[model samples]
Target: METYGVWYHEVTRMKGREWMRRLTLAQKPTPLEPLTRLGELLRIDLWVKRDDLTGDMVTGGNKIRKLEYLLADALDKGADTIITTGGPQSNHAKTTAALTKRLGLHPVLLLSGKPPEETTANLLINKLVGAEVHYFFPRHPREMDDALLRLAEEMKAKGRKPYIIPVGGSNGIGTLGYIDAYQEMDQQRQEKQLSFDFEFVTAGSGGTFAGIYMGHQAVQASSKLIGVSPWLPSQEIKERIIDCIKDARTLSTDSVPLSGEPALEDLSIYDQYIGSGYAKPTPEGMKALQIMASEESILLDHVYTAKTMAGLMDLVEKGVIARGSSVLFWHTGGAPGLFALQERWSEWGGG
Candidate 1:
């Protein structure tokens, strides 16, 4: 095992492959600190990977990791404008908007649903960064993907070199970010002499999970990786992760071959935590937000991380995870998106 420091690396590329290109974005090697309070409450050895603090507070999040590679590819292609799709209050949208602007590239967001009367949370940041947001009511999300491509073509016709990123930046190239992240975490784990029995992460787009899966398999890691999906069903999540892994494998074929691609049955994905639907807050997730904040002094957004935490808590309570097991929660960052649901805070609690 080799030790790597910080996020900075020399200009790395395999020919003109976008997946191989990366820009330094995150603070690197985020703290893998013990969550003693939460651990005691859950009766397990709980810890958190503070990826929420990957960058500055205003633009910080796990998405920055993916953007480092994705945006680098955009710049490599001489892209003046970046386009992506997400919900109206997506953290990815806000993060992309802020970071792209910092790099002097314009961001255009194709968001589902109409603009809200109150521009708060991530949406507020999108406005602050002056991101060009196109609001629409999409019956299906694929419509937004089509819109994004069309928007890119329109921009190209206008002499604006545009780059299009899929929802959540979860593509083959962006997936490389989390592969690096897994190595970083493994290095920290080796240093601390810690080995988690299970590692949990919010699986929205599946790229992050796919990258980590690839890294885990490459290293033959002992800890089991459990992905808790906030939106997609178990089967769908598995398919998306497999797709990402497939696409990512196309970019690099080094000595450490990415063997053992997870079959559908091999994946441990739980979609039960999704109470209602995508982006809708659930009672378990809402309570989880309070529990994490009170116990660990950490905020878990209701849309993603909270649901993942909720799944872990439920598993622990049900004795499925076994008592005294070591568990690590990867905080992929989405606390700002919680502000959009402030109106329902009192209804959910805080009464």
Candidate 2:
């Protein structure tokens, strides 16, 4: 327990639960279902954490889960406006706008991607929710963060209480959402007597992975977390996750000791899956989407989770992971993007 940090006991038990309650958060635990066909294809026992079916704005992605906690914190702090950023067709931005609108708070989206001529599906959805859209043509990643922070500061100067959710809501409180998910999965495993050797997910901002990592430590689950990085280098993702775990531990109570240095599992990220960069889908990703939908009757978006699936398949084929080991693919969800890729699927006999 010595390594659990100073606030460990208070932070882990009632304080963590209390913090969650204060946020008016929705605890929608997603189902952990087995992917029978996918398992057969990979020659492994495969399961999917169906976060895509997360009960929200009509079966939304993993962002909705994080948003439940983050927006709750915003409301708890009496935030009048919610601010966030992502790509033009960002699922996070769209979901934030929807949830903020539902809570009667103004949402401002700062997008760092190509401006749409007719607007993407997510853009139209954001518009419906009355989110003010701001676009910045940033050729670099640092510029995007800078633009978002600068805009938030300007809002503060104007006396607006702006709650800025980081891109994908990948922060401490945001990460707690996945910790809750880990517990949910743990329960499912117990009921079914399932033993997973590892779980796979696509890490965008690293909070999800960090949360799972910490949650595993907390629950004493042996399942290894493998993150397929959609963006950011491996070292950067590892460092960010470490920092998040440190902060989470700092906020936790002393009775829970995460004795080891916060670290990511022995993970592999096939950077090739990121075709042109973030937001652009790869050829293999498109193929994977078609295969998954056709074989498994599941839809995957081009950007985040689909690419992760493609990578997972590749790893399975290459024997990077043992073939027969039980694996869970976190279906992070962004199927709205499939609408934008109609042309790509047209050749594949899209309905």
Candidate 3:
């Protein structure tokens, strides 16, 4: 197996291809480290893929991986401004704002929900990065897409080239980022002679899970890909992932190949961790965050990673994952969100 660097070079060498459209953003091959004490507690040989360290201090996260491709496509289309949608404390919105600023492109965010009386965490970062933010309470999340399209049209009428990035940037282009990531992980596995029976990640917009799943299929990896949903129902996530996989197949025939369409069974999204609803802190998730912080010195956010950890722990406790099994947890990065939910943290025994 070729190293990630080698594989990346080969893929990018296809200059004219759509899948080749990507900007260099993330620090590649984010360290895959052993979780010794945590593993012992679960009775599993656990490892973590540290995607939290993928970029700049404030902007680092799995979102940057998608932005590398999404933003590159924006630039390629001669877009001077980017229009995207997300929740107020969205990591994707914050990363898009930061990266767009870094590349000298304007960012306009149409955030869902009412504007907060006070801004902090990702919202504060978005402001500091100088993104133009608009807030609305959408009747449905899909309505945000329409809102973004209308905004893009208005921008175009003003003679500005505006690029619209979907919520979570889960499109075919963004999914390519994780396809590359899967190859990178495979290379790492081969280099270290590591084998994991299961690979886990938090699934929100579904693009990340789709990309990873496609990548796993592309590499014929043996591990089962598990997605712990912190938002959306399992069926909804499955549909979105299936759509993304289809889009990814159309985008990257050379890398991922045009295999048959992935079935619903191809996805494994667990919605049990989405307690109370999106972005709301759950007791199990809070406990999971405490466990990670206390045991591994790792911080997980209430909305994503902590819930994912909670799900993983639940599986272990239920004996679904056998003792001594090898597991790989993909840390998608949301530590910054901790500050956004400080009040909730206080309730979790932090003050």
Compared with the true structure, model 3 gives a TM-score of 0.93
Per-model tally of clashing residue pairs: 0, 10, 0
- Tens digits of lDDT, candidate 3, 1-351: 121122122224253443466667888879899999999999999999989889685746899889878877787688999999988898898888887887788999999888898899999999898999998877655787799999999999999999999989998888888888888888998898999999999889989998898889878888988999988998888898888888877766446643588777768889998987888888898888888889999888888999999999999999888999999999999788788777666775454
Clashing residue pairs for model 2:
7-252, 8-252, 8-253, 8-254, 9-253, 9-254, 10-253, 11-253, 12-253, 23-72
Query: Candidate 3, clashing residue pairs?
Result: none
Model 2: residues with Cα > 4 Å off, grouped in runs: 1-13, 16-27, 139-141, 252-256, 263-272, 344-351
The list of candidate 1 runs beyond 4 A from truth reads 1-10, 15-19, 253-257, 349-351
After superposition, the stretches of candidate 3 with alpha carbons farther than 4 Å from their true spots are: 1-19, 348-351
Candidate 2 structure lDDT: 0.75
Deviation of model 1 at 199, angstroms: 0.7
The TM-score of candidate 2 is 0.88
lDDT string for model 1 (224-247, tens) is 899999988899888988988888
- In model 1, state the lDDT of residue 76: 75
Give lDDT: candidate 3, residue 210. Answer: 88
